[model samples]
Target: MDCCSPSRRQALLWAGVAAAPLAFAAAEPGAAAAAMPKDALLVTDAEVVTVTDSSVVITWFTGSATQTDRYGAPAPVPADTELLLGEPGNPGSTRTVYHDTAPTAFHHAEVHGLDPGRTYAFTARSAGQDAQQSTLQFPGTGGSSDAPGVFTTLQPPPGRYLFTLALSNDLHMGEQTAGIITGNWPPAFQQDPGLPPYPEVMLEALLDDLRKPDRGAEVLLVAGDLTSEAKPGDVARVRQLLDGWGTLGTDYFVARGNHDRPHVGADYAACTPIPYATDHHDCWGDVFPYPRQTLSVHQVGGLRIVGLDTTTLDAAGGTLDDGQLADLAAELRRDKDRPTLLFGHHPVTYESAVTTAAGPAFDLDQTKARQLEALYHRTPGVFLHHSGHTHRNKRTFMEESQSVEFLEVAATKEYPGGCSLVRVFTGGYQVNFYKTRADLARQWSQRTRGEYYGIWPHYTLGTIADRNHTVVRDLSGLTALRPR
Candidate 1:
């Protein structure tokens, strides 16, 4: 799914509610009371997915009391429910069909026109059943369009620093099997043999860890590959998952990965290369269109954080074409005086020495690398290039060019399935990686942890002081790099 588009999952969610009643009837006797159904199966999986200053989307599932389908349609939803919206005094509603998908069916609603920093309660109901309500709060500061946070009117001192944000990439959301695969040929969508449901579990755990109050990841940057395949429905599903992060009090920014682009059809039988496909128009860009190779400039204390979309080029492999490279050069020149940090999906340099065998074929394109290196040399504050495609833990220094560090993060849905936390102080930065406790990963080990190499601790924290850079190592706090 594209990171910036309204989620189609929201639409599918409401559609699922139409079948909830049939599902409840199929349930065995003496099931949990919370599992009981009224008119629609009770909103079984109500969750807050994504939130912005003026809007938030809530998703939930409804189950049928039994498996019988009153509606004659094929795969008819067992139960039906109406999603009531608006404030308590005046509520608006929409109806949906609910399909029985084992555990339960889902319903999602995107609530808009909300006041930032205010608390709102959402309720779901079926016939004969009282509505189930859940509450969420919006960010206090920042413009509605800016990443979620409390915006401050006060300007920082000449050299003071602001809050820091964390960057992670290569989630490969739906890739569950352990095999050598590419865009040309992908594995079947059967229960990933390694783990029955790797993506779902790993994602839940990763989000849970990032939401911890102490982690302090004000904004979470998911570099790309939110899913293994760029199926339209899969894109919507990933959005539904990421939207859940809003409750954690962090704004999420996503970049498109090669895997996320519309490379396959609904049936996964035909392969449609990039910039093509009659049905999937700009399929990836429209769904998750933040901006191709644009800049997200934000002030944190005294620092200016610039997030770049380096993966805007064609889909043959991860590369930065003439246009994106030129855009980066111009952007750096425009903000040359500010203390800037760059965040993108692909790394200019590979970190783990072990993966060098893959060569540049697995890393950033040569032209793009050269452009970034030149920019770093000319720009004084371009100190860090944070990336995540290699799925390993290693920090590489650009020795040939000006002093800039590349910090490649691990995949959050496979192996460790964790995120990195970075803290920027007045003088330098401190970095730490946290593991995701996704239940799905724990239930299915092979898909998530079987081929895991164990987590790597003693993460490298690069410090840029005096506009000069050097590399140093400390292993005191290193974690496992393999699957747990």
Candidate 2:
């Protein structure tokens, strides 16, 4: 692996970037301030979030050594931010594609006017200093050769455009802290003191982004983990936010995740009790009752969506239960040739790479997953399976179910804060991941990049191909839902 490869930098590193006031003023260009030592600039989490036929968005964080765990202590560094773009091995061809001299903790840049399906190398700079080195050591002056800063733009989806669906999950509304897996060995990340909770900020920003006309999202699907602990208030709040975007069950749909399972607590006393676990209250069920009942299907234009309630009464893993499993089998048998999209909270273990490290806790039970896979093999209409719980972006094709694409998306409440947009067409479809562009949303994402000892990006941000790609298949039968 190269020096700056994510694999080489898997070791823990204690660097954080959080919400802070920009206290430094921009110095005069090409003045004595230009001589600031390169070591003084602390930049981390430099990454490419969105890619298209002609543009890509890059984001990163700038922190100071004074203090980062709280607000007002380590002020935002004042420096010029620049994105250099060029073809690999062509130093003379490199040019500044984007630049901002503003003093800020969070940075976002968009480089436009690029050729489609072409590869390009990039380098992010703050205060005239290369930024990738702070997170991963760069060998010999930080050139982009064999570096993670390389990416190829995606070609547009084949055939005429049909409709678009916003794919997201793991909102974790009402959560107090993030990255608290297992013990304190990995360290947890919390929103800076006095700022609104990070989860709300991210979700609000997400809704706002979807409202933009260019996004062209006719429908939305959240696979699971919609709340922190299935609290009544959190569940209601999530529903309210989503309702503001579009009508529930029509414009958007949701699936139950492990975190949305029933809980035993006085706060949920007024909620409906889980039939299987009488002691626990189904707070999420009381609000989103449709998805909790059983496997359900919805038709949007020409696409068929099947939502599965993967959560068991109070378990961290998931199962479909006997009835839901039977219903699923019957449904697939009934419509074996209809183009279908299946979504749930837990990924099938056979297609999840995280299952190896996180075990069954991160995915559905192995037997249940195999059962679903066998059904998928028999159903030619099932083209995609969307899932959450692993909290990362991954693409896998199982041997038993070669016709379906198993896609796992990153959590919306943390680093790489965004969702995938699937564009359907007559020939096939394309999936592109996009980060929320709001200021607060971008800041929280940069702050949480330090979660898991600053290696969070390595796990959450999948390779460029995984985030953006096109798949060709005949789907001309489905009608396109034009934006109203």
Question: How much lDDT does each candidate structure score?
Answer: 0.48, 0.75
Name the regions of candidate 2 deviating beyond 4 angstroms.
1-36, 65-75, 133-147, 182-185, 291-293, 351-356
Cα lDDT tens digits, model 2, 364-435, are 877888888889889998999998777877777666445888888888998788899998999888888889
User: How far out, in Å, is residue 239 in model 2?
Assistant: 0.6
Q: Locate the minimum summed-lDDT window of 10 residues in model 2.
A: 1-10
Error of 1 at 63 (Å): 37
Q: Which candidate wins on TM-score?
A: 2
Q: Which candidate's lDDT is highest?
A: 2
* Residue 201 shift from truth in candidate 2, angstroms: 0.5
What lDDT score goes with residue 442 in model 2? 80
Alpha carbon deviation, residue 179, candidate 1 (Å):
3.9
Weakest 10 consecutive residues of candidate 1 by summed lDDT: 458-467
RMSDs, each prediction?
A: 17.7, 7.1
